[model samples]
Every structure is written in structure tokens, then in C-alpha cells.
Target: MTVLYRRVLGAALDDLPPQLLALHDSADPRTWSGQARIWRGAGILSRLIGWVMRLPPQGDAVPVSVSFIPQDGGEVWQRDFAGHTFMSYQYQAPNAQPGIVNERFGMIDVTVAFQTDRDRLVLEPMAWAFGPLPLPKALLPTGQSFETQIDDRFVFDVEIAMPWVGQIATYRGWLLPTE
Candidate 1:
């Protein structure tokens, strides 16, 4: 069966590295764990936003785990970063072209576009909404978000920055299939 990521990525799915492909290839629910370094902005607005988003605290080599639960046509990702858990549901974007996916964290939903830079699978936030209200494009977080195979594991680096608030959160890490 074609999985959620595979359906959204379409032909680009073939370009993924072995590790990335392995991570998204499965149709069954599974979990992955690894270590990560996390950071957050110092500004009050950034902190408030981060808190609302349930962002993890700053730490080095923090243990991280993510559970992927496949739903009807979407997938729910439950992530545990040092026991501070947050979840997001992802699926093909409604009324969007292929290579675009929608991710929802609580009341916030963001449409993401896929791109390939060298060996990395880059996720770019195209649009975002808080609840039913569409937010300004300037408020949408941007920066680096990509996944790649580092050695034998799947590695990810995600840096989220706003217009004037600057970087709100960042986490870099690697994941291996939980045995």
C-alpha cells in the first residue's frame, strides 16, 4: 500500500536515501528513538508561542522518541522529547498539488511543501492557520527543515524562525527504528 508520505511525495519518494525511505516506507504503526539537541528563543513572544506549541526545552543529547500511527488517509505522529510529548497529524494537503502535505498540531494546521536539496528532503511551510483563522504569511515560521541519512540512521534538523521574533525552536537529531 502506498503510505501517507509516499502518496504526498509521489515520484520524489524514489529520491530519498535508504534510511529516510525506511522510516516512511512502513504502513504499520511503529516507533523510532534517538538523541537530540534542542534550543529555544529567549524572547517573551517566542517563549509564549513555543509554550503554546508545546515545544521541548533546550537540551543536549536529549532522548527522543516518535510514534507514527497511520490513520484513514493521514498519519499521527506522537513525539516524546525527554518525556515532554506533543503530537501532530499529517496527510496530503487538501486542494493542494502533489508534494504538499498538511500537518496539524492541536488547533494550528500548516501546509508544507517538499523539496530535495542534495541528499536531504526539505520541508517548507507554505501556509498556516490558527484554528479557522488564516494567519499572516509573515507569522509563519521558516528556516531550515530537512531530513537525511547520516551514516546508518535517519537524521533531522529543524529550525523554526518567525519574522521579527527570530528563531523560536530548533532540534537536531537522529532516529533509528525501535527494535
Candidate 2:
């Protein structure tokens, strides 16, 4: 089966850098391990939401592991930073353009537009929903989630921020495929 990102990116997948392509083109379950730095927001709202969302605690060079399990038309991603664990689901956005993908982190479902430019894959949030109810685009919580190949490593940076609450958390790191 075609991977979710490859399906969304279509023929454009060929244009991605080798490191980026290596991570996305797996036919079997894949696990990558590495280290990361996590920064949590200092506000009360940010902490509460981070806890509810199972965001990792702030730490430098924390152990990180990511496992991707393929599904029918989507994939389930399990992530671990330090000892904290979280998971998300990814699938093609129904009735949307080729570059749009729906990702659900816990109860919050987010639609993101995927853009590939040379070596970088950027995920820009375009819509949000909780359960079955649609949410305002203005309040979508994700900001500047992207992945790229840097210095022969698969690097990722994801920022979670809301309208008035400010930065919820940012986890940035590099990983390599592990047996």
C-alpha cells in the first residue's frame, strides 16, 4: 500500500531528499530512535494542555523513539520522548486536495496542508475539529511543524501554540532508523 505522505505528495515524492524519502517509504513497521530537546511553555494553560495532550517534559537530549504502523489507507504513529508517550493517526483528508492530510492527536483532529520543497516537508494546519464538531481555523493549535534532512540526519521540529495561550510546547530533534 502507498504510504500516506507519498500518496498525498504523489509524483512529487521523488523530489524529496534521500533522508526524507528513506523515512517515508517503508512497507513494514519502522522504528527510529534518537535524542531530542523539548521545551514546555511556562504558563498554566500551556502546562495543563500539555499534560492533557501527553506532551513530553522539558529536557535536553532526551531519548526519543518513533514507530510507524501502516494501516489500510493511513498510518498510526507512536512517539516516545524520555518516558512520556503519545500517538497520532495520519490519513488523507477526505474530499480535499492532494496535499491535504488529516492527523488526529488524541481527541483533536487537525487537517494540515503538506508542502514539499526540495528537502523539507512542512505541515501547515488548515483546519481543526474536536470529536465530530468543526473548529475555527484561527484557534488551531499547531504551528510550524516540519521535517527535513540536516547534516545526514532526519530532523524534525514541531510547535504547539494556541491563539491567546501562546506556545504550548516545541520538540525538536534528529533520528535515525534502527533495527
Candidate 3:
């Protein structure tokens, strides 16, 4: 099925950091595997929510794998942590709007914001909805960062926080493209 839309890396994505641009350059689909350490903040409520979200338990460094499959207008991202498949998301890149992500739970609108700190690229949640009901963005505090480390590894960090619940989960890791 051909999805009619602008290129995945359009003008809006031109300002992205070189490292991020390279990492997300999905013109040729491939898989990358590496090792990473995962961490989750502590709190009873946070732990409970993390469990419900299928987040990995706090642990030392483990193996992580990711695959990027290009589509007509966007891509599919599949991630596995420590040999366990966590989640897969289908992304749709709009012509002049934030990218849309369709996950198992719901659909989320994500805006890519560039941080001055080392030209890091951050994914900010703009809107979220389940079924036909719109949900408050505050209810789902999610953050994602991509940066290049000194060792030339592509680093990725993700955090999900909820009001009064502290940090539900967080994971930081580095990856190297295998092919």
C-alpha cells in the first residue's frame, strides 16, 4: 500500500542534528543491535504504572535491538530490549506538522524539538488519544532524546513521567548500525 505524503526527511527535518539524521535515514531499511543499561526511577505508583506499560525492570547493561522498515511515506520502528520485544510503532510524517505515531495503546502526536545542548534531538508529546477520545498530554509525560556520543555511538534516552507519580520509567542506551 502506497501512502501518499511528503518525504520522511522533508524540510522540517532538515535542521535535525547530523547524527540523528544519519540514524533516522531510512532510505535503506536495516537492523541495528547493541548493548545498553536500562533504569527506572523508584516510587510505588511509578513502579505500578511501569509494570502496566510493559517497561523493563531496572537493570544493568543488556542487549538491545532495533529495526527500521521504510514505508511509502514513513517508517516502522521495532525495538527489543534484552531479547524481549517491547513495542513497535508506525510513524506517519506529515507535510508540515508533527509526526504521528500509532502504538498499541493509542495514537500520539510527537513534535521533534532540537535542544541546544550538543544539538540533541528531542521528541515532545504534543497530543494523545485513544479510540475517539482525546487524552490530556499531561497525563502522559514522555520524552525521547537522540544524540551522538564521543565514542561515535548513537545514544538514545527515553523517559515517561506522570504527575504525582514521579518517573514511571527511563532507559538510556547506545546503538551501532550493523549494516
lDDT of 3 by residue, 77-150 (tens): 67888866655455553444434334433234343333434456555665566656767767756666445544
Model 3 regions more than 4 Å off: 1-18, 93-118
Question: Of models 2 and 3, which has the larger lDDT?
Answer: 2
- Total backbone collisions for each predicted model: 0, 0, 0
TM-score of each: 0.96, 0.96, 0.76
Instruction: Residues 2-31, candidate 2: write the lDDT tens digits.
Output: 787788888887788777888887768899
**Pairs clashing within candidate 3:** none
> Per-residue lDDT of 87-164 in model 1, one digit per residue for the tens?
999988657798888899999999899887778899999999988999999788898899999889999999998999
lDDT of model 2, residue 120: 87
Error of 3 at 119 (Å): 2.6
- Best model per lDDT: 1
Model 2 clash count equals 0
Give the Cα-based TM-score of candidate 2 against the true structure. Answer: 0.96
